[model samples]
Target: MQPSSSPSKFDNMPGDIERRPSVEEALDHEPLEKGWWYKPHVLKLNFLMLAPFVTMAAWGFDISMTNSLQSLEAFNERFDHPSGARLGFYGASTQLGGAFTIFVAPFIIQKLGRRAMCLIGSSIIIGMSIMQTFALNFNMFVAAKLLLGFGSTGVQIAAPVLITELAHPRQRERITAMYNTTIYVGLIAGAWIAFGTQDIPGDRSWQIPTILQVVLPAYQVLTIFLCPESPRWLVAKGQEEKARKILVKYHGGGQETPLVRAEMEAIMAGIEADATRIRFNKTDISALLSHKGNLHRILIATVVAVGSQCTGSGLISAYLPQILDNVGMTSTREKTLINGIINIWTWIIGLGAGYVIPKLSKRSLFLFSTSGMILTFVVWTALSAVYTQQGGYSYGIGVVAMMFIYNAFYGMCWLPLVVAYPLELATTKQRGILFSWMFFCLSMSTFAVNYINPIGLENIGWRYYIITIVFTLLILCLIYFFFVETKGLSLEEVATVFDGRENYDAAVSAVHAVEVKQAGEPEEQHVERKDER
Candidate 1:
């Protein structure tokens, strides 16, 4: 509501298009909205937002468990001591499976909706995980995990997009950024279980740890039924009444408050405005390439996706046992313990970064992370060179410290924003397409480095850090020039960063303007408007 002494700051502007306080800002100033976040409906909204943690944790658990398994003597003996190319295939199998089905995820999300995609993905993971846990042969085990990757890609595509499109406007940024932190939770759990089970007899040591991986995905399948579909997705499918009801129940405390109306109005306006520009259920690949603003988004998505895996993580994350061996450490138990500790460290860093992300721009976050990595790699490379030539124990210790420092920077930016950045930058229809491309690209990059990391580490030793240092510099340059500021803006407001202000839909703030007109007068609270689509 406007104060009596002053006109809106936009009063002198030339166009009839209006600008108003964001609904989030207005809600903060409203006396009626005190303790708003603690309300029961908003709590329920947060629970729905938290439901995807199981899906994220599942990925973390798999990566950590697989990493620990490589160091286990029983598992190696059970599988006939897989080494060289066979071991590389063991790590690359899931990624290879992702390459097969990643592009199809967007099509399913576009047709059946994001909720449907989550359900289907969880169900597939559940089946494949059971197969993985009970497989009688190594070939059967690899086949089961390969199919599991096929399913994980679907949830990976939908979960972040759900948080992006459905969270309450004020909670969206932090929640979406924190969304990936759940993966670290999974990683920590996996590490603890594998370390604890190290002394168990025979195959149970590994099998028991693998069985726990299935539990999180099964939990997601059950909880997803209790949550509402994305209001934006609902609106795109001509289900405006359903979208409004869901928003009123959750975002408005079961009433059409000004905040709720403002958000709904913005969603309707954005969709209606983009209707001519996008076909809601159709594939957006061609549409995205044809549009200048969207194409720029795709380029950033590629940089983020490819840069995330390519930036020296491959050697540390999956091959830490080998790295430790090169540094003259040789206890299997010690290696397992170190694996657990590193993940705990990563989880702590992930939470800290997620909490702070809302206060800074996305561009600021990525630039800081990439720059830190560049410096870490340069020092790390020099340390490795010294340890290899001079054979000093102190040089080896310094190299290990540098690995932890490098991942701290990686977790600060890449772990959280890998998906969050692209989803926020996308238009409604572009969400699914952007996620598919990002994950597909991520899979391909991970696959490349999975093979390259072991061979490079064995052949050239520490010189592999040189390649990482150079590639990461290019990533930092792209982020500084391309990533835009989107600290507190709603999804519609974000379009202005890519598309110029005049080119964005002016209808976004029109309903808020109408509310400003009736601010002081006693009138109905509901700002009723049709869905226009």
Candidate 2:
């Protein structure tokens, strides 16, 4: 929240034509909120929110993995056989690549800004797609997968911030949902494309689907150049004036300009006020860890992220076709098609749930999702045991039903909530850093899950489901005690909630006041960009 003294000074202050700091200044004083989503420029930026799905499509790349595994086998014949260690890297590279991006994104955002960083990532994706098409050996394949993972990480971290920056509070959930929805769309698309290309004879089959992956990122690169840089970031660097012009361009006409300007000025006053109170330094682990509240928020974020990955979702996804094959599926193509159908419906329902979450208590929704996971795991464990006991077509059919049901429930709950929770918790100043680190932990968890699955299934018999079920129950306990409701709250309000310094109502009101103040202000006229400053 803005310091008490700062708001009092601005409460009755005169609007000056020349004294206002840039957009960055105001945002630095206040925080980005729901109201900002209403501006035209901000709204237009939502189109690029589709980028996450593009990254997520890589997850569904496994739709054709059976074919790829065959291709891997064929490629290995002329060369050395890829070890489990090496093969593990291929599976884990996507998340490992994500970790690399998480570690680097904060610094990159600090240097190039979010817009430039997103564009660079998009370029890497397009380049990686081309490279993957030509990879001949396991090492080259690993390099291609790593590059693709890094590119996806850029999208994963940047998309939500972009949407949060560009959207109004009323539209935030919907806009964010668009990003989440597109990812599922990407998954479905990857499944169908890879599925369709499965029988084209030789390595040429994989090339088509791999090359098709470049289309979305290439479009994102083009779009980023046309879109405005984030107004929040602009405000942070003292580019108040530029930020204002963009706001005006987005708002159009003068109808809302004065109100927007007033909010901007108030925001600037608050930021300038806060700047006077604190030291300026690059955001880092030390800064975040030094504060107890921030530490709590980080712990919550890490657990949520890790939990999302640990629910056995990645394991189910990686081995879907193989699972189907085990369950007596007739053909790979048929299985991929059925899998795509399940995924599409699952996401459609999941997106629906995410849309409603903002209206419901975040805590309640978190509990509900956690409960669904617990139930899903219980069922999964029972089904695994049943299949072990019976071992026939009946058990295989039961396995199919269990798989479909798990994906359906999972997509509706865990998928969106995991991403939504972290985005809703962190402060604007710490968001990029927090989300990146969250993704880092998520990637690490993914690496562990994917690496352990082959070994676990081969060595443990039927113990994997039992182990995962236990984690789901533990996560449910975490949600009940530590997680707070963030629905309808602005980012700054979320910051307050995490800090535990104020009552829920008061903290939310404080954040709302700050956001409304920022939204209603006009952009400052002569502020410097980060580079210029």
Candidate 3:
């Protein structure tokens, strides 16, 4: 179990005859000074990073629109007075499609690359939105829902990986956090659109909002092509020169700077280490399953992914108006207006959280969020129970207020971390597959919650809060015990956290060797080191 100084075994697998240069041999390159963020290339690179968020915003619009659609009289009338149970299935369909998509994503992402996968996914979303707009029956609409889910899963798997790989190490958290926060923008758009259009006569009421879902994805498809493919992905494919060029352009001030060389070496070293441990082929599940440290990663990621959906936020987002109705805000107009306001507030809070994330530790933030959710659910449950028993506006208002508070806390804690943590945890070689698995967990939990929330609301009412309270408490315990701190580490460096402290030290040493080698230092003094193995 001792760490090896040299690359892992998979680095030299049979038929891998292509001779790639070691980090020291690859370049004669200056350390990029601090404040690289102010450079022109970095500024443009930051702007391009927003493409994934645009895709996510479209997905968010669909989700919030579904919640609004359930309350729209025109939609209900046009679709033949569909029951809440059926609406739940409609809500769950996207997740069901997403679950199926994850199994296929690893192959697609490998063969086509991250940019292509996102393009394909965004195209599917555009098509599905059109189909939903013109659907003649509930069945067709359901089919559109399923297809959109499949499409968005592609974007979900690729977007985070793309942004994570493309980002400068110093800004990765802020970039990913901002990506997560964009969902609220879509939610707010969907909410206000639904609110404004709900009074229109005939099918156009729901149709207008459904059709508007195409705008963001259309923008995404147009702009995604302009963004570069992941540099890590490029290296794994043995296009090191291309990867290096991208690093220089975006991260190294258009030169093969020392910072770029160190980063390239760090990435290559991690990939080599991962290759030694796991099969390069996407189909080799056994390799991924048996790889050292991967199981721990999978468990942590699965818990975080599934936990985000099942901890009652899915219930809130998918059925907000219904929950409002349960709490005595029975007017459709009133409910829609309140939902619109809530979406705006959630977006504002989420944007604030994104800005502050780099200052907080992952473990502390997750624990704080889950703790707040538990308390909010307790208060909400109490108010809801009272509202259900004694017909009073005070308890009802309290219930509404608690829901807003719960969303605010959830926005601050869970929303930003879910995407960033998994990307940080998995190494480049396993990132695509890891994201697929994470989304698989997400889709499964989303399916279960979306399907059950309506039924639970009907049968038990306030008692549903009890289920979320228990789940939130359980998540709190899991985060405390299992989640590792990953703040301020490069994605490659984060790999060592699971592998071992010795392995981490080895990675640092490898990067340091490159730094010293570039600085004209004595090889004996700086490069020579023990294998530990």
Candidate 4:
């Protein structure tokens, strides 16, 4: 069979012709059991789906290094005891590079497939890690950090989209939650590595951790080729047979089963519906913006992306030691120990939440998380205020406890939802672009928080907690009002929720009509074989 270049076989059909196979007709197939999740092919598919998150962990390793490096004597000796402002710049540079990638990724993702983009991202990360490891000057180090940010953007944008496309519809949430949860594994690894090397007398203390950053990306580059291309991407690229083969292999037990056929039809229908509203061309930004529900999705994506960063996570993660110093923890060893422990706690809680995510609603999770954060910040701010005035060890301890509590809630809710929610909200045709925009929002928020945080800590002290408390409360209200539930829908079905019920029904009908027209001879022959029916 030839690869199709057009969006769909129905392209030559007239604009006024609205015929389609019925939704019922398309859905008429043997009932497939949910136990497909236990099959060997499905298990292998899950592993392949999750492989990219190692890169996410690598990204976390970079972020978590800042906390330990701040207090390490060997690191200070090499970098000349940089000021808080300069260190903040080092952290912000990565985010700045990430923000820059947002504009360029849409084009790259469109031209190259998701797998290729992931490989490119991994290669960039590997090269930057090598550069960062051997940097003789501060500027060289910062330049390497900036490049890591740029490379990470590709990983962040492509990874989730690949998972969404490849995951079983019933299991997407759990799989995505797993992806989000593993990012903390990198953070925990980085923190412990820094803590382990803190007592060393030479540059190797810091250099070793920096060198270790290459491992996960190296693994990604070596193993990513083992995974299949996203079936949705293949179909969108007009390689339906290839897409069908993938679906059968991974999802249909290596045959064109009814379940596989149904899924392909659904994906095709969604693509056709999307193409009708928006040209599939990369230059057609207007088509995306002009769609009825896309703007709302954009708003939700931006708010979720920004809200995840703005909740004071940047301040705490990047400058835990400084925050601890403010709270009377004067020992460097003590501060590093606490930072490592907190990351471990985050990883633990995040892993548990991954299992629980499928059982809870997205809005409920966000509401609970944001609400818990507000309460934690309120108490933490009050405790900090008391500590600032009276200087009690108890108040300082309370502040630290609140930090752990805040991170627990954050890991449980925000971390997993941030990537998964935005992926679900976007149509297949616009998934990459939407993710790019989401990451742009994430990078901007991270940059603002990282750059402003050190200065804020210096100037306002605990009063900065008040800003997060207020913003988090506002985010809670936004979640209650606007965020839609998308717990169990397949990727193609998700489009219907946004496009309105009537339009969805129409789109399904149009898809069915096209399928009937294309299969006219075979369908008629099958019907004749059925005789009495």
Candidate 5:
């Protein structure tokens, strides 16, 4: 099939088309059973298959390392560095590896099923763990981290797609949140482990954290091996019967055959329908940019992805130990404890937001969350500087207040919302490429920030957050000015919105009209994710 170039599609689909499912019609349907959460077999399978995602504990392996020695002077002496430059280099390199992963992921996803991809990711992490545990020098350690970054990319790309495919429509956001939550769980786990082990005076003390990294991925591998393949992947591979069996087993009511069949049929229909209208070679970045609407969606996705990392999460996380020491939380153990707790609790908040997200209009959530981040940056920037400069107890309180609110708001709003928006906004035909470009932009932005944060600290001190604050404000303004609310809208309906000739209300009306004929069921059907579909 010839790839649909950008200009043709963009010319065909203009903005200003308003399209939404009828609230009443949507309300009339009963919620999909939340039984998957309670189903022991399915839950077991989910946990196992998702192990690679949960194994993100490695990201925090360096948290306590920063806190190992007493003061920055002491840390510098032990590491034989006048500054934390070595550590900063390590972090930036790791994130740079993530950027490489984004460039390679589309082909990887196409060639390998989600399960295989996840397993391979876990294996890469495991190998990197060994490399880290046995590292003889700085270069080896950095290389190990780079490998971990690559492995982590596999998990990052596959986990959301897998969870979205397996989860009931109502629970989609929650499941995705669970994926993020597991990442924090790993972080918290790593922190606690680091604290528990950092006191050892031997050269191998750091090895404890590196060695511990192996456990999560190891566990993930053992557990995931027993889980069923993604039904969507199964269908894609022409294993319809096996896909139905697995779907029925996990989806409850023991009578999911019909639902599975319906889902499969819908998926096939959707594929056929989409194929007839749009064609693209997955590898061609230019093909992705060919459609005006597709081009616009890619831009939006890229902006959102880049904006996510610019929020200063990486800055705070990388510098947590340093920041904590500045605030009189001098005990490495205490700092580790606090770090662990923050990661865990923030994850809980993210998970909570996910639970309620499906009910909110995507527009409302996006606006609210984007605004919340801007507010957080404002407060955090002010308080972080005050705490850093003034030696007042009130300033300390301000720092804590800002950190707490920042974590809460970030977890609840941006974490899952950013991811969900891109996936929902893109047409299936372009989903992989759009997401690839999104992650690519994210990795690039993240690497840039990681590299620059240290420079910011050395040159500007705590005032560096001001840069992020400006970006945060722009994020909200951009959402308000350029983005459209895409809540519960079908892809076709969303496509109709970008045809700029129509007025906003008129476009929406057109979307409403197109949706009845073109939109069949929500994309949550049991076998809906199958390859054919």
Candidate 6:
């Protein structure tokens, strides 16, 4: 029952090592299915998962506030009607703040636990929200935005990694799906709040929505303490008993079960064999680049991170109101209303995608989503050209309709899989680097898109969609050629997809042995999260 501080037991299996069933094939399903919803401990774990879900809402609110505020006359007047680069800089500054965190993030992830990062992120954003609400000048407002990016980027970096590590086996895919989608919920809240207060006479029109930005980050702060740190992180830090008890509650549903032991064994084997650990240094980076498998994982991480923004969603996210203006839908109330409606639509589509996510392979979903977007953008861009040249209201309206279609296709897969796919790809040893790099790419691409989008629309009109159209097509080719499917595997088992069949056989064999031999052993702790609640 000692922690797996030593190398994996199966490194030198006697005689010929036998191939073994994967965690997916060996998983005990009957116990997990019986009254799953009604189980109290299980119910509590689900509630705790909400901590990460709300973090994205904080991000969504910022995006919505940016997009909505740009359309507001009062906000424009207050900021002296920023246009071109000044306007672009305002939206892109947050990503600049995010880029600043890239190097230090790995050190923090190594030392502090995941929950600590989440808490720290939420606390930072709360102060920035207040700073933004009462800004004395545009300079003060941009400063708030720069820091808001820093805070929100911290939350974004940790939240999905937390979800991928902490979610129940049955719930991981769907929970991760729902996590990113919460941004749309935050979007809806920000959009409607701004819309609701738009008619007010003065500064309060923008101030109300800006100040209310603290809502979700504050909620994350209050609830994050309820969330357990990642069990995988615990085991790597040599706290196996605490890790075991966490798995027992969330993975085993209270008691020590075969499934829980299998997961723990697999995790230990992964840490031991793959050098997954609590510390990071130059060596981890070397290891990350040393293998073709790890290189492939990094490649996919880049695609997902950059692709999420490049698929034209970034333009809509930062410049939807301008997009509306481009297509001749110029009324402030109508623009904000359309923005609010699109948020609701994307949220609904996001929830629907959750059920479908569990059913499709990751490769299949990425391909389908990208293809759908390519088609939507082609027609969307063409319609915008018509609007620009002919000046027909129907052409403008058609362009608006295409945004809805584009979001639906994007929502089906990219919405959720951006973080989940990249996290799943990285070997545990390289998770921190790949996660940081993924977000770094995301922030930079989003910054580039957000910064360039308004200028492109202003200078070139409808032609801006052409750039994302070309980028998204390249993304689709990458998915078809390079992406690996990780649909049915447990988190530990996912390493085998990158590490090869030899390590796969050893890891799976160890899990089976542990599950059989340790199924009857007494746990050091059990159902403790119940008390946490």
Q: Provide the global lDDT of candidate 1 against the true structure.
A: 0.77
Which regions of candidate 1 are displaced past 4 Å?
1-21, 30-36, 276-287, 509-533
Q: Residue by residue across 113-194, what tens digits does model 4's lDDT show?
A: 8888888888998999899889998889999989899998889899888887887655677878778777788888989898
Model 6, residue 268: displacement in angstroms?
Answer: 1.0
For lDDT, candidate 1 versus 6, the one ahead is: 6
Backbone clashes in candidate 2 total: 26
How do the residues 376-439 of candidate 3 rate in per-residue lDDT, one tens digit apiece?
A: 9999999999888887999988988997999999999788878888888988867888889999
Q: Residue-wise lDDT of candidate 5 within 25-50, one digit each (tens)?
A: 33234344664466575566556555
RMSD of each: 6.4, 7.7, 5.0, 4.8, 7.3, 5.4
Model 6, range 287-370, lDDT digits (tens) per residue? 546667767877889889899988898888888878888888989988989999988998899879976787888898899989
Which segments of model 5 are wrong by more than 4 Å? 1-49, 52-78, 82-85, 234-242, 252-258, 276-283, 325-334, 384-390, 427-429, 482-533
Which candidate tops TM-score? 6
Clashes of 3: 2
lDDT for model 4, please. Answer: 0.79
67, model 5: CA deviation in Å?
8.2
For residues 414-531, could you state the per-residue lDDT of candidate 2 as single tens digits? 7777677787776555667778888889888988876776566656545777888888888888878888777765554455565543332232234334544555744353343343
Model 4 error, position 233 (Å): 0.8
- Candidate-wise lDDT, in order: 0.77, 0.62, 0.80, 0.79, 0.60, 0.79
Instruction: Give the candidate number with the greatest lDDT.
Output: 3
TM-score of each: 0.90, 0.80, 0.90, 0.90, 0.79, 0.91
TM-score of 4: 0.90
Number of backbone collisions per candidate: 0, 26, 2, 3, 20, 0
Off by over 4 Å in 3: 1-37, 276-283, 501-533
Model 3 pairs in collision: 10-276, 30-258
